[model samples]
Target: MQWRGRRQSSNIEDRRGSGGGFSGGRRGGGLRIPVKAGGGGIVTMLIVGAIAWFVFGINPLTLFGGDMGGQGSYQTSETGRAGGGVDSTPGETDNFVATVLADTETVWSTRFQEAGETYPEPTLVLFNDRVESACGIAGSATGPFYCPGDRKLYIDLTFFDQLESQLGAPGDFAQAYVVAHEVGHHIQNITGVLGKLNSARQSLPQDQANALSVRVELQADCYAGIWAHDTRAAGYVEPGDIDEALNAAFQIGDDTLQRRGQGTVVPDSFTHGTSAQRQEWFKRGYQSGNFGECDTLQGQL
Candidate 1:
């Protein structure tokens, strides 16, 4: 992905070194402990964290034990934000992300305008290690996510490293695909998919809820493909760009994660769909370039 030297998104927020931990207060070191759901439920939280870490791809450190001193208080380790501080490498990554985000904004804005609606550009918060969000306190292990509550997308650039080293999906376009996927979630949130998923989650069994999550995730993948379609048409994507993204799509699919973690496949436990499904839907979106084509829930799964 030839992303350098491109225009970045104005909605990007550089909170990479802002207040995260409590008491001492510093960047990338830890977070100011986030307010948990309730008092006296620490064990439940631990269990929740363990479950979520596996199911939702969340890291465990974001669960608890941050210093949480008042905001704007503290020191920085010599490393400086777990290596994010003053690092130009991530800055380059952010530049690429910004360009892709800008592209998404353009495409979605046009799409929305065609529908007689206004597209509100969402902010992208790039961080390292740990961060706090309206959805809850989150760490880098949570990967990239879109929070509908605050209408923002949170991502740890280090996930790019994981995508290369851990997930074996390496490339700038692959990283952009990740960003597009989250923005896809943001699109879903605005389009009422989140409410439907929430209602399903509330009423369904665990397995069924996981199934719905798979649909939601696959739809986002498709939406990302739709974004890619526009970017490609605009001459931003190269010949092998789609393949790089598909490799990424395969690497992080729920089926891949499940097989890696649990040694077997459980269809009911799949939250992000199978690798084939992800690749297929992404291809569908890229081919159709239609938002209406991303309905993962309409047909047989």
Candidate 2:
């Protein structure tokens, strides 16, 4: 990924050193999922963290005290760090993030214009340890997430360290995939797919809801691939960049995560698709670069 010297997004809200204290609880019913975790790798933490939010409608931090049995600890802000105050200056990592976001804005805006609609660009919030969102208060343990209520994507750049070390998916493009995937969710939100899924989930059984989640997540992966397609067309992608993203998609697949964490694969509990399925959907989008081709809902998977 050749992101240097590119335009950086002005939509970023830097709250890195600001303490994200708990206040009023979750304000609205919206879809929220953590993208990274500590013990048991990304998938294991996602399962636990998802239960904390999706099932119980509470903050994941409330349940982090239990043994997660993973290699790394959840990234958190220390007292000294939290009190140090926000750093307005953009660092190397921050610049990379902003550049990626700007690229997504350009791609999605073009896609929407083609359909005779306007794209509402989402704000990306950079936080440390914990952050308050309209959906709820989330600790870094919950990883990067998109809150539909506020239409913002929240991330702790430190999660990239865990992505490379704990999850074993490294590279600038892999990091870019994380941002693109969340923006994919933002795309779903604006297109009304997210709202419909949330409504349908309310009446469905657990297994069925999980299935819906898998489809939704896979579609986001496909959307990320679409962004990759546009980015490549714009002459930003270098050789091996696509492979790095594919590897990331594989690393976080529900089946792959379950196998690593529990030594078992339970299809019914899969909120994200299998590794093959994820890669397939992503390839579909990357190959076609069409939103119509990326539909995972009614199309054969």
Candidate 3:
């Protein structure tokens, strides 16, 4: 990945230094205090969380923005470093994110304009441990997610390191695919697909619900591919980038995650498509770059 000294995202809300402050642990025990859960998190954290859970075997400590899952309120302290967390230098991470986001903005804006609709740019927030959002409070553990309530994208950049180093998926395009996937969720929310899904999930069986969830995930993958296609047309993507994304899609398949989650894989419990299916759908979107081709619900699964 040739990502360095590139354009960084100005839309980012940096809060790495303002993590949940640490209070000294119990006497002689020295237990680390969990930075107040989801205080500083952004939408990207949800993506990190999901991918980390499905990809890496370990869970991250915090996320960047606040999400819809905020169970409790938290305020990131300017108080003191609980453990002197990594200083925020969003160079490569911020640059890659900005380019991808910029690409999405261009693609969606044009696509919507073609249909006589206006596309609203989504905000991306980068944080360290946890953050508060309109949806609710989320921690780094919450991963990268988009909250429909705020229309923002939250992420913990730390998750990127986890993705490449631990999760088995490496490369800038893989990270870009993750962002594109979350943005896809934001698109679904805006287009009313989420509303319909929420309604359907309430009345469906657990297995059926999982099936729909898988379709939703796969659609997001397709949308990510669509973004890639448009981005490539704009001279952003280079050789082998597509392979990184495809490998990511294949690596995080529902079957793979299920196998990791449970000793045995059960297709009925799958919330994301199998490896081959995901790769195929992503390729479909990438090759065609057509949103119409991403109709997973109406087309073959």
Q: Point to the candidate with the largest TM-score.
A: 2
Local distance difference test values of all predictions, in order? 0.65, 0.69, 0.63
Tell me the tens digit of each residue's lDDT in model 2 across 192-242.
Answer: 887777777767898987787788888988999999999999999877778
Tell me the deviation in Å of residue 273 in model 3: 2.0
The alpha-carbon deviation from the true structure for residue 95 of candidate 3, after best TM-score superposition, in angstroms, is 2.4
After superposing candidate 1 on the true structure, give the runs of residues whose Cα lies further than 4 Å from its correct spot. 18-90, 299-301
TM-score of 2: 0.78
Candidate 2: residue 9 lDDT (0-100): 84
What are the candidates' C-alpha RMSDs? Answer: 9.2, 9.2, 10.1
Worst 10 residues of 1 by lDDT: 68-77
Model 1 superposed RMSD (Cα):
9.2
| Every model's TM-score | 0.77, 0.78, 0.75
Who is ahead in lDDT, 1 or 2?
2
Candidate 2 residue-pair clash tally? 2
